[model samples]
Target: MKEVLLVGFGAVGALCTLTSKSLSRSGIARVTAVARSNYGIVRGKYSLCLTTRRSRVCNTVASAADQAYDYVVVTTKAVPELRLTPEILSPLLSPEYTNKFAQPTYLLLQNGLNVEKDLYNAIRKLNQGKPSIVCAALYVGTNLAAPNVVVTNDLVNHFSQRESLFLGIYRHEDHTTSANSADETALLQDLGSIFQRGGSAITIVPEIQRVKFAKNFWNLSFATFATLTGYTVPSLFRSPPASKDEQCNPYLYPITAELVQQHSIPAIKTTMKELLNRDPDNSHVPSMLLDARRSQPMEVEVIVGEVHIDMLYALLLVKQNQILGRMMAQ
Candidate 1:
């Protein structure tokens, strides 16, 4: 059976676990997930069946590395300021693991542009071979309410929209070519098939980085707006404030919304076009905003660093300084 290792078990990671479990049945694959602190909850979520073919969910990367994995799906956020991607993937990049097993294909399921370079370089150095990387732009509306609870915003009746997942094989050297080996292509297709079996809109595209650039463009666009305004992107779309709380305080309402459309929206687009381009579903909050609200380290480097929009980057840095300032005060 093919072996799959799923890293991270938070909001996005939990959803991926469901898909990984689906891939496990039918003698197709066996999954070993590194769930970290959520081990008990994640382990309890799955059934053992008292059989040998049951999947495994462990606490650490070392334990999950007991066997070789054919595919490594990392669903963690790209918070390079706190931890680099290569460091987060230390066990998988270790010479001990690379020397023992065939290099596993990596599937990175997160936002931001050019987040795969560090991991790609690390794997290339260790294996001395061409790396098989699958880059995707995933759009799902799920939030981690607490540690293990993930809430989605899939409304029905005239306002129903399924998630969008665009998968493509990535080569650091070339972006347009999918001339990867037949086996790699089959694996990528199979992965898309498995992810799509649950009704998500999954598309296999040839130009993935360009697609990622497009997705990241929207993310950074709204994210910068949120940081600058101290209001979520959904607020701009609420149309005179819909929520009970928002209805009470409607300052950042339609006029602010106009400013969003006229200024924030167009300026970011022009900046990206000059640079080379790239949120809806209003209930969803941008990840950077969420991180900022929690006083945690935001994903500045991966999301805003590449584009070099100095104004936006400075705003985010100021926000990060505020987070640090709060900690220092405490």
Candidate 2:
């Protein structure tokens, strides 16, 4: 049987664990999870539950080194504060264990662009046999409701209404022009089948980068604004007043009025339209806003820093164009 190790027990990780358990039930795979804390609690009483549903207990491992894993699914947050490499790899890739354990397939289920590069580099540095590295851009909405329980939103509608996960092998070249080799194609297909067997709706694509960027368009636009303004995703899309009197009413909540006014609505629409011009279907509550609400450090650099830099460059170019226009008029 295939042995799978899942790192992190957050919302995504918990969902993955449920999938792994389904695989285990089918006798195709056995699963274990590695959580940073609450080892005793998880080992004895760990359970994965949906919101308002019964809890199902899960298997927990204190350390990843306890057993050799065939696959490692990383579902941790893609924040720099977490020394991910050392924390994840040291137990499995240390000098003593590296030779004893076979190189495992590493599946990254994190957000942000180019999220797999650093971990991939770390694996290559091991100088062992190259392991298969797969990246997934997931669109499922889930939250950890308790230490051992994960609450998923609209799971029933996911299969019929929404695509859940997009899978692809990591490629440095532009995916639009790049084709996967026969071996890579086989690997991706196999992984996709495994996930499908576990009841996950997965689509294997040639270019996961495009999917990541498309998803990030919504993230960088709405998430950044929401983080700064303390607005929820649903709140941002509230219907505006149809009349000027209603729009200018001072009795309305200050922040709500500001957001729903014609002046602010146009700016919001322009920003969203600019970002989503390439992919209009992209929409989700920004994970960064959730982080801000939880008082966790947001992924400011990866999610918004690049966009902010591009905006600065555009301003500079506009300024230069204005100066050139004045010179021409003179």
Candidate 3:
């Protein structure tokens, strides 16, 4: 059986695991997952059952004696509070077990722009040597409906609308190829086929960073706005300015629009278009937004700050351009 290990079993992790299980049961790959804390129930339906053949290890490391896995999916949240450094993964990253599960193909299913850079630095400090790494951009919108259970939209509807997950392998600077190098075509094709078999929609691109940056823009915008204001999705989406609230206060709508359009929207859009060549029409509410609405600490620094830095450098490249005047005029 082809073996796989998943790290960080949150919302995306749950979806990834379920999809893996379906594929494995169909003889695609054997799967196991490692979680920091074993919440007896995930999402809402599946109970954490140790009796199953597929293992779920907690507070343990897979040494070299254990067979190397085919894939390692890292789904840890990219926020500072939830970040997983190589030192944090030292127990499982030790060299003593290199012969075992150390050489598995790795995939980081996280959000943010510099995750690969951070992971590389962390691993270089902790790992014996580099392992193959792939990057995944999980596009499906899902939430925990119950312990061990996740509620996702129907696969058919999701794919039909092109809301399926967008996945891509990574290309480090050391790789001797252009930004659009076709290194992982076969791997992406395999992954895409696997996801499709599991009833998911998928598009595997060569440059995952572009898509990653694009997603970061939407993430930062929603997270920054929703966090500062204590409002949930239903409330914000329903309570538009032109709605009932405007009768008593005409200023509220324009104020909100100006805040969004002037500060958050422009900053995000400018960064995304300049850096990743992304269009503003395709938008998404990032996980940070969900966390903020629920009164959770924000991931603003990692997601938004990185983009701002990149945008500054981008601005430098076009500092003398005529178009700058037209863009800033708005």
RMSD of each: 6.9, 11.8, 11.2
Give stretches of model 2 more than 4 Å off. 19-26, 47-62, 155-162, 173-177, 240-285, 306-330
- Between candidates 1 and 3, name the one with more favorable lDDT: 1
Error of 2 at 204 (Å): 0.4
lDDT of candidates 1 onward, in order: 0.72, 0.63, 0.55
Q: In model 1, what are the clashing residue pairs, if there are any? A: none
Q: For candidate 3, lDDT tens digit of each residue in 120-238?
A: 66556555576457776655556654445566643224222344467776666754443434446776676566557656667776667766776676455444544445443333343
lDDT of 3 at 137: 60
What is the Å distance of residue 280 in model 1 from its true position? 6.4
User: Higher TM-score: candidate 1 or 3?
Assistant: 1
lDDT comparing candidate 3 with the true structure: 0.55
Q: Over 4 Å off in model 3, which ranges? A: 19-26, 42-65, 81-83, 99-102, 122-130, 153-163, 174-183, 233-286, 289-297, 309-330
Which is the winner by TM-score between candidate 2 and candidate 3? 2
Kindly report which residue stretches of model 1 are placed more than 4 angstroms away from their true locations once superposed: 19-27, 44-53, 155-163, 175-184, 238-281, 324-330
lDDT per residue as tens, model 1, 1-330: 567788888777776655432444435556677888788877776546213446778888877776778788888888776677789778877778777877788889978888888888887787568887899987665667777687766421112232367888887877557455677568778877656553456777766887788667767777778866878766655454566665554356888888988899899777655432223345566677777878877878778888898889987899888887787788
